[model samples]
Target: MSESEQLMVVDSTGQPLYPATRKKIHQEGLWHETFHCFVINHEEGHVILQQRAKQKKDFPGLIDITAAGHLLAGETPRDGIRELEEEIGLVRQFEQLFPLGVFLEELILGDLKDRERVHLFLTDESMPLERYVLQTEEVSRLIALPFSEFARLTDETAETFQTADQEIIHRDQFVPHPSAYFRRVNEGIQAYRVQQT
Candidate 1:
C-alpha cells in the first residue's frame, strides 16, 4: 500500500472521524480499517497462509493471513476483495466471501502504533500452490496447512510442521497475534466447514 494513500480514521465506536494519510494514521495511533481474507480448502481441510514479503513496512517476512490489505479512504469492507487479486492473484467476487466477523487489534511496535478494525472473510477455494502469481513486493510465497494442525500449533499443543520442501517452526515464523485471536479464527473456519456439510 502507498504511504500517501488516504485512510479513514474512526473513533472508539467505529464512527468515521477524518481522513489521514496512511503514514499519519500510524504515527498518530489513529484507528483505521483493514481487511483480512482467509482461504480454506474444505475438501482437504486446510487453510492457506501467505508469507509476507521481507521488504514490507510492517511485519516483514512474517507468515500472515491468506490475503490482507488496508482499506483505502471511503472504501467499504466489500471493496477489500480486490486485495486477493492484487496480493495473491486470486480473483474473487464480493458475493463469494463469507463474512466471518470484525476484530479490533491494537499493537505498539517500536514507533508504530497500529489500531485497526479488521474485517475478516472466509472462502473455500482450492488452487494449485504453484499457480499463484504472488505480488513479489507484498508476498513471498503461499503454504497450506491442515486446519487441525494449525489450531494445535496456535494452542501450543504442536511444535513443527514438516512440508515437502521445508519445515516451519511455529514460534517466530508466524505473526504474533493474541492466542484468543487465533482461537476465534479457528472457530470461524470450523463453523463454516460444518455449515457446508
Candidate 2:
C-alpha cells in the first residue's frame, strides 16, 4: 500500500489494536488510537458537537465528539490531547479533563476499515463558540444542543436529527451511538440542575 493508504486491523471482538509502530498488525484488521472530548458548556446548558468535514475518510458530515484524532506511532495518549488542541483550538491539559475511560471498538468507514482504541474525556470549558478556529479540512461546522432538548430528542420517536447549519443534512453516524452517551450524560446534567433549582 502507498504511504497514504493506512492499514487497519481488528481483534476478535473487532476492536482496534494499536501497535508500537506505524506498520500494519499481524492480525486481521487495523489499529488506531482516537481521542474524544465531550465538552460541556455548563453555563449555557449545552454540549458542543462538531460536524466532521465531508472530506474525512469516514463518517464525514456526521455529528461527532467535540474533538478527536488518531494517535501517531510512538506517541502516548498525551499526544492525542495535543491533536485535540490542534484540530479544534481548545487549549487545556490532560489533567483538567475527566477521563471517561476507553471505548474499544471496530467500525467500517466507507471502504476503509477503522478499529480504534478511543479514549474519552469530558470537560467544562467556557469559550465563545464563534472564536473556535475550525480546521476546515477536519471540521465543517459546530453546533450546541440544549441540554434538555438534546435529552428530549433521544426520547422522541425520531432516532436522528438534521445537523445544525444548512438545516437539511440529517446525521446517521452510529458507532458509539449519540443517544447512548447522551442519555448517560443527561442524567448528570439533570441532577446538577435539580440541585441548583
**Largest lDDT belongs to which candidate?**
1
TM-scores of all candidate predictions against the true structure: 0.93, 0.71
Candidate 1: stretches off by over 4 Å:
156-166
Q: Give a tens-digit lDDT track for model 2, residues 1-197.
A: 12333433335443544443323431234666667777777787777788788987556677777887665555556767875677678888988776666676555544545556667677777686788888888888778766755675556355554432324323355334545455655665666556557
Cα-based lDDT at residue 64, candidate 2: 76
Candidate 2 residue spans exceeding 4 A from truth: 1-28, 152-157, 160-197
The CA-based lDDT of model 1 is what?
0.84
